[model samples]
Target chain A: MPWAIAAPNTPPPPTWGIFTPGTVGQFFFVIVYSAVIYWLISRAKAGMPVPEIRKIAGLDAFDEAVGRATEMGRPVHFTPGFYAFSSHTLAAFSILAHVASLCARYDTRLIVTTLNATNHPVLEEIVRQAYLEVGKPDSFNREDVRYLSGYQFAYTAGVVGIFHREKVAANFMMGWFLGEALVIAEAGALAGAIQIAGCPAVVQLPYLVASCDYALIGDELYAASAYLSKDPVMVGTLIAVDWFKMFITGLIVIGVVFANLGSKAFMNFITK
Target chain B: MRRQLPVWLGFIAGMLVIIARYFAFPGFTQVQKTLDNWAMYSGAAAFLMGMINLTIVHKTNIQRRRENWGASLVLLIAMFGYFIYGLFTGPDDKLFVSIFNATISPLGSAMFSLLAFYMLSAAYRAFRMKTLEATILLAAGLIGILGNAPIGAAISPWIPSARNWMTEILNTAAMRAVTIGTALGAYAAMVRILLGIERSYLGGRGD
Candidate 1:
């Protein structure tokens, strides 16, 4: 035992070799980050100051899109993008509920297309409930909530076909769209439908902007439901998010200045 | 009750996985992994459910002599061919891969490319220089496009530099704001789901 201590040269086990300061530090950082997110949410319920959101042009066009359909005497085509289960999809679903309710109130025909078969029953129910809530239960059409093919391109083709055949006056595309964003938007354009598109796919934003009358770029897609429905929790969360953003921006500014001055100690302390 | 049981189980399983990932507990992590494996297997099995549903629909279409009868026949043949190919030659076989790559890939690309033409037409028809906002959008788009292109750089280095600055500084700030807002919204939605307040997923009647 004395000889082993004196030597003090043997490497640790292969798995434990990298169990150094950096590894320990990173492990702790993740824990702290997660804890902070949890704490933020807990404290957020108490209420936060509302952040002033600059007007989103895409949202202002919602009424215009609906009005166009009404004027044209054509049904509104609303596809909640391709995602059926994601957070983006849920946001889209919430928006769909609002839009359906509005359509019911306006006595306008609403056509919903789902790329996924599983989404059919849920979407049908959503439409039914929305219509009932608006005192227009009879306006809800089972045939309108059609489930097209699950094949991505096939679904796009089917939607485009419908747009051409029905001459949909207004087209609302919101959720997790991919390459099909431009294709769908273009079809709506060809059909003379006033198109409003919202997708988190940044790469596809250019296509949407070029094709659709109104495009909700990136994160504004998430704000669609909140803006439409004015839910307290939704609005409160939006405010909390702004506070978080402000905190991040302040940290970035301070960090930049400190790093420029070569204050390693201050930088490390602040980062920690 | 069947749906409710699954939903409850899903909620419990989801919470356990999150906790396991956060806490670095070996036992919890193992449980989470096991549950994930089960889910993967179940997902594979669920493919049969979809296949069955599709078959039923196509069969009905054929029996009723629906409007798209020829399309139904083509679909049935393709499906059966796919199944036979998988059964006899395996999924990694050259024939299967070649057919998929040849048929599906090009069709997908062609479909996606349709957007470009549509965009040009849409822009021509809808993008009127009517309001101040519209003017601003048109200007920003033009600048953004020019900045990204090689032609802009060839004409003047300042165009590319300006584009870089706009993308890095202005766009980054805007994007960050949106990300924060989205994250908060998602967090709120997750809370609603956890508390069983958002029962839209459960369809109607709330169970």
Candidate 2:
């Protein structure tokens, strides 16, 4: 049998030359999906009254965490979950910029440790700019921005060490965390620091939920920076995402009903 | 211009990567491959830059006699020593691999095993039956664990079936929802950057 249905004993036909045929549906949606976001962004930019977006508690806690750090006279620690450039890391950086600004405004020390060699300079620059934007450039300490290690577990261990040694007041974890998430998050918890963690890695949610005071579950992590910044364009993108999700969820529920009622038509239609 | 250049470059490069995926244009793949090759080279250069940065930071610490500066010294030695050794023997050489295995393998395992204890702690906290939802979650988790364990078969024949059903049905459904939501969220974020709406990642740069 062939991978999705074909004549028995027949060699699989040549792959589709145009439009990665198997993925055309998803590809088409990707375009439509971005278009929807663009449209919403435009609307908001035009001063349209966008509906109030749902509150993400993890996001709401960001300033609170930063404030706590300031009050406690301890530094704030930030690590974007994974290393290198990806959507997860990119999203995480958005939050990092925000957190850095908070640290700068409060004149509290900020420690950023990274495992990705490429992101190191960019992260540092972001923090520096954040301080400069807040008119506190001289207060920014280059030494506090660390490139811990290129190794995953080594970075985790180093972060744990920072949590203990620095006695961090607030811990922010966001990005593409893998197996090292729990090790680091637990360290933050043990240090009695207020923690807000978010990652695209679904399996790591349990650890974050248990250890962190607030956990950005799933896409909430992605929506975080937009949610925190409250810029019209960013908020518009979020509004678009939420609307699209509702639409997709409706389709899913209907498709499920049809599937249960003995119909493959919806599946075939979507897959096509 | 400084800010605008990165936005334009990112948009063009990202679109090219996306286009190269679905369209098998004659030279598109080659162009994409070339771009990727350039990225890898840049990443290697970045690695060197990172090493230099690490050295500078630690050297300052040592000079200042800062707290735990000895650890910084050891870190520098280990880092540069490994770098020199790897340069001489190549990354895949037996000695290099042996050293890597001795260091990373066990350390990674230790970190991974720490997950078990952390998981237990997390589970104990999360699985508390504080509310109806928590109780249901606890039930589902217990069933999932027992179903995977050998003892489930010994405990009750129906338990395994229940666990399998929950995983194959409920767990998969929830996971699908999460995966799709994340994909869309990521997609929106990508579009935002492409459109230059989310330019903070560009570090307070241009329109």
Candidate 3:
């Protein structure tokens, strides 16, 4: 029925109140999963022990990169990648805040570039506050936080120009990078900058890995922020997500086993 | 209140959209259209944010007489010139289209074309058999690269089959893992934001 086309004059189907009838199972699943995560997070906030998150090498290199920038008397370059209000952008901002704070502490010049038009204003404020928090409010320069270009390739070109011109000692690229990841990263490599890149963009992961000195793969991009900030709430969310992933993996294996045995009940319930 | 208001609004609007998907009521379509329009208008208005920041940044550079500040001046002039031209002649005018096609389009393509050379350099470094993992990765990559190229078929028939197997089986499995991990991470991040647990966007002082 979902696939079938209705007659031109036919009346539309009736609604199933506020929740879709077929998706009730999905809604329930989400709610249950959320509840579990919420409970774990609450427990974590209460100072209960949660499983330790893996030590992400790329995240660990952030402080080293910042230190290197400080020692070399060169600026640190950061980009949140091309994003317009996405989860990846949010993750990127957390790292930006962390990096900016470190730069402020080290009295190192920090240059943050954004390709997304909307992110530019918010990013400026974020870097400003980060400097303020580190007691170096006067160090935040407006010129350094540039909104290069809204277009992806133009942004890449602009970033490449910066790497060549400014001669940044350490470059941190964390966000929703895509095809231009390599172009910018390769420029960083050529400039002899300690390049650390992270993105959940799997298609571009290989490129980042190839070009960057350190690459955060898969969920590491999301987890890196928590690792850097060491915020209880962020850490709690990270831990909860790992457990949920394991739960989903279990479900997937069970589903596959049942499916192989010609049992379509689980699939039917989800689809229905 | 700075963070709370926006967070509350986002949560309410997101819930409305989610709820709207279930019910095909008489007025649901109109509500969806209204919400979509508001989002579109907001996104369009964001271009102004970019313009203001661009002006501020370049203006500072020019004031300080920073290195290559001339480029910033040129950018400002070019941007305003284009804006004035579009304002008077309309954006759809032949001149406007001609300028965009001649300059902007080609410049964009030029930047994109540079990616090929960058890719070669990156691949050259990555494909080096420096470590066990690197060697295995280089092997897999070689299979993928050669299988797609015409020369692979000329070299050996099995090369193409091996490439297809590596991509269709091994690559697909790895891709799925990454996809699922990213989906979960993104979903969890959104949930945290909606619940007001994540407030980095607000530049809040954490407890």
TM-scores for candidates 1 onward, in order: 0.75, 0.92, 0.92
Model 1 RMSD to the real structure?
6.6
Clash total of candidate 3: 0
The best candidate by lDDT is: 2
Interface RMSD per candidate (angstroms): 4.7, 1.8, 2.2
How does candidate 2 fare on TM-score? 0.92
Please report the interface RMSD of model 2 to 1 decimal. Answer: 1.8
Ranking by lDDT: 2, 3, 1
Give the per-residue Cα lDDT of candidate 1 at B110: 87
Off by over 4 Å in 2: A1-17, A257-265, B150-158, B204-207
Query: Candidate 3: which docking quality band?
Result: medium
lDDT of 1 by residue, B104-178 (tens): 789888887776677667566445678786676676666778898989888898888888888899878776766
Against the hidden true structure, what lDDT does model 3 obtain? Answer: 0.83
Q: List the residue pairs that clash in candidate 2.
A: A81-A174
Q: Any idea what lDDT model 2 has?
A: 0.85
Docking class of 1: acceptable
True contacts kept of each: 0.29, 0.63, 0.57
